[model samples]
Target: MRFDPQPASYRPDPAILPLAPWLGDPVEAATFPRHDLRFRNDRWARAVGLAELSDAAWVDHFGRFAPLSDNLPQPLALRYHGHQFRVYNPEIGDGRGFLFAQLRDGDDRLLDLGTKGSGRTPWSRTADGRLTLKGAVREILATEMLEALGVYTSKTFSVVETGEELVRGDEPSPTRSAVMTRLSHGHIRIGTFQRLLVLEERDHTQRLVDYCLEHFPGPTPPEDAPDRDNPAVRLLHQVVERLADLAASWMVAGFVHGVLNTDNMNISGESFDYGPWRFLPKWEPGFTAAYFDQQGLYAFARQPEAVQWNLGQLAIALRPLCDAKPLVAALDRFGPLYTAALAKRWCWRLGVAPRGEDADARLVSACERAMREDGSQPDAFFHRHRGGRNANDELAEALQGYAAVEDEAEYWSDDRPETMVIEEVERIWAAIDRHDDWTALTGKIAAIRRMGAAHGEPPVPVGHIRRDRT
Candidate 1:
């Protein structure tokens, strides 16, 4: 689709005041010889009031080095330390990218415009902070697929091809280069809080907590909640709940994040920093996405544990401001929360209204057993058996009391499910690499959207059976 050349309708509204005091060292974006704007998300742009920008203006704001009006005058490379694969690294931060700007979305939620492969910062330890065009494409695919599957993830706002040849050991040497931006709810990570603890900045930690509570507030705590008045404890509970839902969402979608480091865990519970991510071809607990994850530390099954561990680190960072008992209690709720979330999401993916807690649990177990016995891919399995219609005897029996929530659609008539396997992704990239062909990529995105629409929104778990239950 072509971008509209009209003047932008919406004015810029910056809301990053809470982070002003703690802003890190400012940095400049790299001056690329080429600024080829390849992709622009018009849907998201409209939501943010930037849909009407002319092509040149779009490139100027996203591609060129020009800063957004009323936004940050200069990019701020945030400071934070994280545990990479279980090892604490104090020398970590936004080495290549920085927080470019913050704006309110249609929902009035604060959204951050963060860059990847922009340029080097003080944290760029001996490495060039460049993002390959292939990496940017992969990120776009990852975020799009995850969003269609109902996962809370960042939107790949724009990808501009930078005129530079980058040599990397991963893919072909001297690969094409690009810079991308992500629109996320917030970038305040678990490691962000950890940095305050590392610096012994108790006052700063309190300020950060208040900022999050005000800007990135989560569900309100129960009336009987312990230390509910304390922003630290409240943030902890909210984060735990969000992370638990995230873990369950991944499981239902058959996605492996590959990297579950503290820095990658956003306070808003949205998934970002897509690297070495994968959609499982089948139900395998020990499946690992990244080649470097030989030990499967963040394996498919271990993701929950990994995220919980990261939460523990966040709790540790908040220890100075809140009691330990309340934090531990919050952490302990992960399992139950994950279990409940999985059941609800599973029912949604299957196009079935949840029967009840116990019945839905039994249905989930039955579905898993069927998939394992049949050796079917999760995507295909879910697509074929939506509403528990085309299931085997066991799954059929388990889903007997539940009814389908979605009506028949064109996507349901397709011979195969739309999947983002490695092979398919490579093929799409090959078309782009050999010849600047975006047809395949665009087509795949359309198919994925169709599937998402066919599945419809998740049904609320009502104990009473629907009259339409077949």
Candidate 2:
């Protein structure tokens, strides 16, 4: 599909006010002559007021890596530290990518245009900073599927295939190269806070808290709470709630993020930076996505624990600004909050109206038991029984009190539900590799969207409701 930018509703607002203190030195993007724009997310473009740029302009900005006129004059390679597999890695940062620009969405919320496979930077660390086209394709698939499943995620805004052959240890040698951009709420991460703490920059830590509170405020803290007015405590509470909901969403969608490292965890609670992600074929907690994860530290069932541990690191980072006890209090809420979010998400995915906390919990348990017993594909299982249909004796008992919220769609009438299993993904990629056929990928995306529409929107995170109690 080709697009020409018309009179764009484009509104550029470089609102990363904290960039001055948080960003590292500017870097130049590698200029590739072939700016073959492969993908443009028009849905998100319209939402961001950028639905109208000419094709040439789009390529110039996203493909050729030209600086946006009113956006950041130069790409800022953001500096931060993160723990890789529970090991502290102070050397970690934006090695291959940088923040391209920032703008406000139609909702006036700040959004970031961050790059992947753009070029090398100081953090590149002796490695060429180019992304294989297959890697970019995988990210597109990951983000698209996650969004369809109602996970708050980054949107792959643009992808341009650069004419270069990259050799990689994984995948075939001399794979094609590409540059892509992801539009996300904010790039601030749990690791971002860790960097501040490591530098002994208590004041910067407080500034970062203020930045998050102002830009990405969550439900207000309880009015009677000791740290209700404390921005640090409030931010911690908000991160916990968002991350918990994120973890639950992944579980309900049967997604394994593969990497739950601190650097990959966005503070805005949006999931991005997809790598080695997978959707489970059956209900198995020990399923690991990455080949390198021999220890299964980030297995499907352990995702909640991994995320909570990351939250703990974030809490520890907040110690410079607030009493550790208040942060602990906020951290303590993660377990119950995650449980509530999981139940709500599970009900939504199953197309059932939540009867109540206890009943919903029972329904989730019953669904799990049914899936395990039948050894069913997660997506198919949810698609088949959506709205409480085709339930066996066990599931019927738990589903008795609840009602299905969605009507059956035509897609469900098919013999099998559309799924993104590993083999199917490889089949799609093989077509691209051999014949440059994008039909399968595009068709699969459309099917996934239909499945999402069949289920309706997911329920809002339970922790989002504010309990003021003044």
Candidate 3:
């Protein structure tokens, strides 16, 4: 238990987001590398007691002056427009990104952690708001691999490479600038309800829709939401039921943020930005993660319709603050709340038990007849059907002339270790799969130091990811 980056007291939410006079000031544009940190994993190993803090004291107390917590939300560098693939940029807001503050954690909640390439600013248009230690090691390996595939994402904390350098004529040599820190819950976008439904600004868009239904509408508040239901069209069916359970937890953990826009939706419907993100390691619902999306428009099966077209740009940014038959009933709550939160997050990542009617129309006709003919790689069809693995001759040569696994020839199955483990999840997935089989990659760091001598856990690497706190 050796880490703590000194935090008994460290305030910053000092506020200042009112920049929209056509946004111009924010341009310091670079800083990071008071010493670089390239440690790579164990999800920022913030080991036990958050290991005595340094890695440059987790960048000056978690997120260097995180834009000095912009005095708690009144900070407004906001104003936006999007439709990247459908066309219609009309310029955007938080361009190279910025909104570096808004605290309240030790459980009381209110997060927002921001800071992507802490450089340029005034909505960085001519480029270089700097961020590229290969995009901060691909957003610290895409937010700790989507927080170990559990999802509700956005939480890197600090990555800071920027030993300083930049050229990006689109990567490879001549690129280095970096800075990161995520944690989020409300960077408030969907284009801040599409810039208050395109400037009709009804009382500052109903005071930002009553500051997002007095802090996220969940454990109460939806008693059939306002008028036949219009608490801003049932908070857009509760942010499309948390962005269709965050695009069915990024289609059961193959993620691909690639840029969903409506200023990268968040107010709690997590999975913020990891730029051209990726992780399908084989899957391919036209898998994308931006390389200029070549018209796939944020693919991986068009990420729940690019998050229901950024929740129809937050029902056209909460349609001038509501009323036109509850703004088309809050844009019909993004297709049955993103198809029943992507069929209960794909029946809890393929353990598959949920099926209230045609078993979700036979798993969306076995995922659109295997993503429309011969579709077999989505991680080798879920590591051979849900990670059990056997490979049936590499799934009959990667679904050769597909009969779509010949109508699942009596549900061709396997990876069903009853849905991704539980009872001590195979003693931590057989110790990270025997530390990924054989040569004992430090045998689960010597069986967590002989189970940290009866569950105390402090053997240190900063007491290992506290393996989910014991």
Q: Which candidate is the best by TM-score?
A: 2
Error of 1 at 309 (Å): 0.9
For model 2, the local distance difference test gives 0.83
> In model 2, how large is the Cα lDDT of residue 310?
98
Tell me the tens digit of each residue's lDDT in model 2 across 186-293. 889899899999999888888888888877867876675568678899998888889889899999999999999999999888888988999998999899999999
lDDT of 3: 0.52
RMSD of 3: 19.9
| Candidate models: Cα lDDT each | 0.83, 0.83, 0.52
Could you estimate the TM-score for every candidate? 0.94, 0.95, 0.32
Please, what are the lDDT tens digits per residue for candidate 1 over residues 1-470?
11221233354555665565574778899888899998898867776677888889988888875888787888888889899999999899999888888876545566788999999999999989999999999999998888778787888999999989999987898889999988887788999999989899999999888888878766666577787778898888888888888888899989999999999999888889998999898898899999999899999989999999999999999999988988888888888888888999998888888778899899989988887888889999988887677876888889887988756677777888889888999999999999989999888877776766666554322221111111
Q: Which stretches of candidate 2 lie over 4 Å from their true place?
A: 1-8, 462-470
Off by over 4 Å in 1: 1-13, 458-470
lDDT, candidate 2, at 411: 68
Candidate 3 segments whose C-alpha is farther than 4 A from its true place: 1-25, 32-138, 143-160, 163-188, 194-242, 249-251, 254-270, 273-328, 335-337, 340-357, 361-381, 384-470
